[model samples]
Target: MDVLLAAAAEVIALQNVAMIALGLVIGIVIGAIPGLNVPLAVAIALPITFKLAPIAGIAMLVGIYKGGTYGGSISAVLINVPGTPAAAATAMDGSQLTRQGHAGKALRMSLYASIIGELVSDIVLIMLAVPIARFALKFGPVENFALGVFSLTLIAVLSEGNMLKGLSAGVLGVFLSTFGLDPLTGDARLAFGSQELSAGWSFIALVIGIFAVSEALSMVERRGAGPIERSRVRLSDAAHRLSREDWRHAAPAIARAAPIGVFIGAVPGLGSAISAYLNYGIARALSRRPERFGKGAIEGVAAAEAGNNSVTASTFIPMLTLGIPGDVITAIMLGAFMVHGLVPGPQLFRDNAPFVAAFFVLMLVTTALHLVIGRIGLGLFIQAVRVPNQVLYPVVLALSFTGVYVATNNLFDVGVMLGFGVLGYAMNKFGFPVAPLLIGFILGPIVEVGLRQSLIIARGDLTVFVRHPISAVFLVLGVVALVWAGAREWRGGAARGASAR
Candidate 1:
């Protein structure tokens, strides 16, 4: 309570009006631009913020994290492009709304729903972090490994029509992760004797290749062949707000997605993409008119934005309390802490109570700022995509090249980017989902590390995984999911054969 009061005091001085307002603008712009992440913005600003007191620096980063996560939805909704994968779910229904002429209303509802989710998840993090962290502290390697497996299971159905390929991608990702020096053994695995290859692939480079450059190649292939651009007349100037019924229907969805987002985000290793997908699944599962989903359903955008933005802040809970960063981004934040000479752990919470609290306060402030920009600046975000694909495609390629350079300043990553882009475009062309590849890349390392650690602790006994109840439950669920997906695939094949006969 005292910590919050101090945070409020600091924020009140941010009553500076200019800094907060400028931060908001910077955040939105950074987020709307494809290939730029919250970390990029935060890293760029960190040196500038260093001049300020600790509270202000922390507050600005927190604000960027929150505002940037929401800002991506604006771009995703108006264009078929997702500024961030977290915004991919928003794109699902939001892009559809563009075709239906309710783009403005969809954007408005997404902004509002995002604000609601951010506020609710902030409350959950502030109030519930202790208990959750306490439980997480009890988690052994086996439990953690099983949890990682569970995360992979969520992507089983998400792989879409090519589960074997998904498995292949996942296994390859895990194998690639082994190229680095092993944590326990202090020895390299697949470095092939090159000092540079010892680091394997940089995370930023991989994301750029898969999300940005790959998107560029796919767009290039479809250049002048996409669905007609009749959507330019979307949302006449007079119709700029969500209908009462829209908000009425969206409220329940926002509520349902919030807990799911919070829980998923608070747990280490499960990021917002899975949370958004899960929320969309839940909203569709519970809807009276399930067929409305993916056909410009307002609920889809609302639930997705809610889950995505809320999880951005929610991931901090485990990070701050248990010293376990929930996602790679949060893990970077942990590194940011060490760079600032601040040790990351529960003790830091004690030493920097007010500063830590300021981080929490800024999330709410950023949400409010996002609402203002979303309502007013949304049109610009939408309009910016008016550039022709031929012109924009090069820009994406350039940015993809730049992002790759930023990681290692190496041309090898650029080559890798082009290769992955072609591979990604091939998969997309054949109607395969990209979600599994991403999930696999993100979770594979964790699963490998966890499984290795658990096995080492148990002297090579795989049975040790089931000794813990939580691990056993998750393993059981993973087994059940694999069985179900396999059975469904067999049935689908049989049905297709019968129909052909």
Candidate 2:
């Protein structure tokens, strides 16, 4: 309690509050832009943090981390582009809502859900860090491999009405993920003799190409010898506000997904993207009207946003408690911790309890700042969709190339971005869901590393995964989820056939 009071007092300073607000706004803007994500934004701002006092610097980063996670949904909903990879699942329903003239409501729900998740995860991080980190530490290679496989299976099946296509896309993504050098052996597998390929495709380039560049190309195709109307119309603030029904649906989804996000986040390597997709699948499966999903369902947006944002603070659990980096963002924050002469792990908690408490207070304060900044700046973000395609597409193209180039400083990445953009457009033309491909890409390496390591530990015995009780449970759950999805799809198909007859 003394520590809590000290931390609370620490955050009440005018300088700290100003820095938090600044970071929140900057993070949101950076996140709202395609090709720019939270980690990159935080990295860019890390140097600036060095000039400030330790607590203030950490507070700003916390604010950015919280805000950027939510900011990605702005572009995902309004432009069919995800500012961050985690927001990709949000695009499925969020973009549909934009087309249907509910951008305001979609944006509103995203902000609210993000705050709810962030707040919950922040509290959890403070209260349960030690126990959760201990539990997470128990996940060895076998358990991770099983969890990744199970997540992939669930995501693929939830890919909306066509399991075959979804699985195919997922396979392709996994195949693509194997293009770089093998994780175990440094030997290149499918680099096709190009040295550049050895490093693997740049994630930012792929994301920008797949979403931003592809959207721009589609806009060009839609140009009918004249300027096309704005895809998103300007709606009033009141129009954008969530209805009571929206809250009712979104509330439960946010609640369910928050804990899932926190759990996945506490365990290192899962990341926000997987959390978003996994929670989305769970939300759909749990919904009474599962058919409403992927068609601009409020629950989908809520789940995806909540899932991603819930990772914001909980991701620090493993990092702070065990000195393990939970994700790339926390990995960066780890540097900030060390720079301030503060080391993570059990010793730091005992040695710098006040500072740790201050960190916790900063996280909660950042959540509140994120809420205010998001609300104030939402209309400004929605205005981007109101710009005509002729004007907007060119800006998007420029921004996409610039952001990618700025991040990597390599022209080759620009080419990769363009190539993937074309691939994304082609996939869209073929009626394939892009989400599964992303899921496969993200989970593929994890699955590969875990399975291989587990096998190695067991001297190539296949039963190694089943030998561990946790791994065995996850594998069983994967099979059960697959069966449930198949059965549900079969029943739905039969019902549709009967109705048509």
Best candidate according to TM-score: 2
Compose the digit string of candidate 2's lDDT tens values, residues 285-321. Answer: 7788776776789999999999999998889999999
Minimum summed lDDT over a 10-residue window in model 2 is located at: 224-233
Compose the digit string of candidate 1's lDDT tens values, residues 204-258. 5655565566666766666784332435634455455687888777889999998
Q: Which model scores highest in lDDT? A: 2
Residue 53, candidate 1: C-alpha displacement in angstroms: 4.1
TM-score of each: 0.79, 0.94
Candidate 2, superposed: residue stretches over 4 Å from native: 224-238
For all candidates in order, the CA lDDT equals 0.70, 0.86
Q: What is the Cα-based lDDT of residue 123 in candidate 2?
A: 95
Alpha-carbon deviation at 309 in model 1, angstroms? 2.4
Candidate 1 TM-score versus the reference = 0.79
Worst 10 residues of 1 by lDDT: 225-234
